[model samples]
Target: MDLIDTHQHLILRDHLGYAWTDTLPALQGDFTPADYARLSHGKGVIGTVFMETGVDDADYQAEARLIAGLVGKGGMLGQIASCRPELDAGFDDWLAECKILSVAGFRRLLHVVPDEMSQPEGFRRNIRKIGAAGYTYDMVFHARQLGLAEALARACPDQPLVLDHCGNPDVAGQGFDAWYRGMQAMAALPHVWLKFSGITVNCAPGTASVALLQPYADAMLALFGPERMIWGGDWPVVNLGVGLPDWIDMSRALLAGLSADEQALIGHQNARKVYRLPA
Candidate 1:
């Protein structure tokens, strides 16, 4: 089946600043659109949404513009640009720029920052502004930070929010019950969605096999159902452990029991709906 990758990441060394890469050894170099295309070819990747690589604050706009310009250069469907709502200075102007570039949504790397930062009045207010403008927000938080995710979802009830990496659960460490409960709580909220990506990257090395990833996938499929769930390759990050092709096969194995339509909903349909991608 063809797939629509909703959480794909790309790296451009010359144009964007990925200072975070110093510690991320597995992802230490350029991963351009051409690289992704080579891997995605015949893997059923019909289209993709470019996810931000958490570049330096100064490079946010440049990165978004660069990625946005790539939309039709390849099979890119759209981009989820990076934004800092808490900065609160010139944010409206920045949103106007995003609109001009035709970005599909925005993301702030919540996992790397202090939890308190997400709760400030400035952050909440800006998030509301983003929602009012009809853009989805990708909440990239760690497993322990689901409370923050819940709070943000509540604050921006009208904003579409997506929980990445199955809430970054520690499947290798067997941290299932806690994450499962967290997923259940977050799913209860009407506007929150979950992305079925990044499981291998979050699990302990050497422990991210298909068998291990299945439970987490099943739990998400059960709680969020096909409509509330979307799928992505997570691209270069998947190279850290189970590479893209293997990860795709593993995802298929985990979701083996679903019918064709249900599989399509998780793999493609839901992404277009959640991210407001073109048909």
Candidate 2:
């Protein structure tokens, strides 16, 4: 089935600054659209949502603008721009700017911030504005922070939220039961959706096979079903584990037993709906 990767990250070291990449030698250089096009070629990928690469705080808008220029090229459908809802000042103006750029949604790296950051009234209030503006909020947090994720979803019931990376499960250590319970709670909320990406990075080295990831994949399928679950490449970060092409192959294998329509839903259909991509 053709795919619309909902969680593709692009790194342009020249136009942006990513201090976080200093520590990770594997992701140090630039990962341009051309690079993605080359890697994803012949992999059934037709479109992509350019997920923010967690640039420095000052570079968020520049990062968005950078991706905006590349949107129509290399199957880049749109972007999930980085945001800071904790600060209310200029939030709406920023949303207006992103709207002009045709951003698909917004994301804040909750895993890197304090747990209490999302609990504040100001944060919740600004997040509501995102929904009010007709944008989805992508939640990227650790597995331990699932409750926090669910609480944020509860606080902003009207906002559409996406749980990234299968809730960033601890597949390497087999932390399944706790993760499942957390995911189940999040799944109970109809407004929340799940992204079937980044699991390979959570697995131990050389152990990211479909056989190992099947249980987690099955649990996600069970929790969110086909309509609510979407696929992602996770790209250079995914390279830390199985790389993009291998992950795509593995994802296809896991979904091989399902009907063609079911595979299409998770692969591209749900993404088009969830991210509101043009048909």
What's the number of clashes in each of the models? 0, 0
Listed per candidate, the RMSD to the true structure in angstroms reads: 1.1, 0.8
The local lDDT score (0 to 100) that residue 216 gets in candidate 2 is: 86
The local distance difference test score of each candidate is: 0.86, 0.91
Highest-TM-score candidate: 2
lDDT of 2 by residue, 1-279 (tens): 789999899888778899888988889778988888889999999999999999999999899987888888777889999998988788888999998786999999999988999998899999999999999999998999999999999999999999998899998888999899999999999999999899999999888898898998888888889889899989989999999999999999988888999999999999988889987
Work out the TM-score per prediction.
0.97, 0.98
Model 1: per-residue lDDT, tens digit, 1-279? 568988889888988788888887889889988898888788888999999888898898999988877887687889998899889888999998899776889999999999998998789889888888889989988888898999888988888888888799977678898888888889999899998898898777777787777777878888989889889888888887688888888888888889999989988999889888998
The TM-score that candidate 1 achieves is 0.97
Off by over 4 Å in 2: none
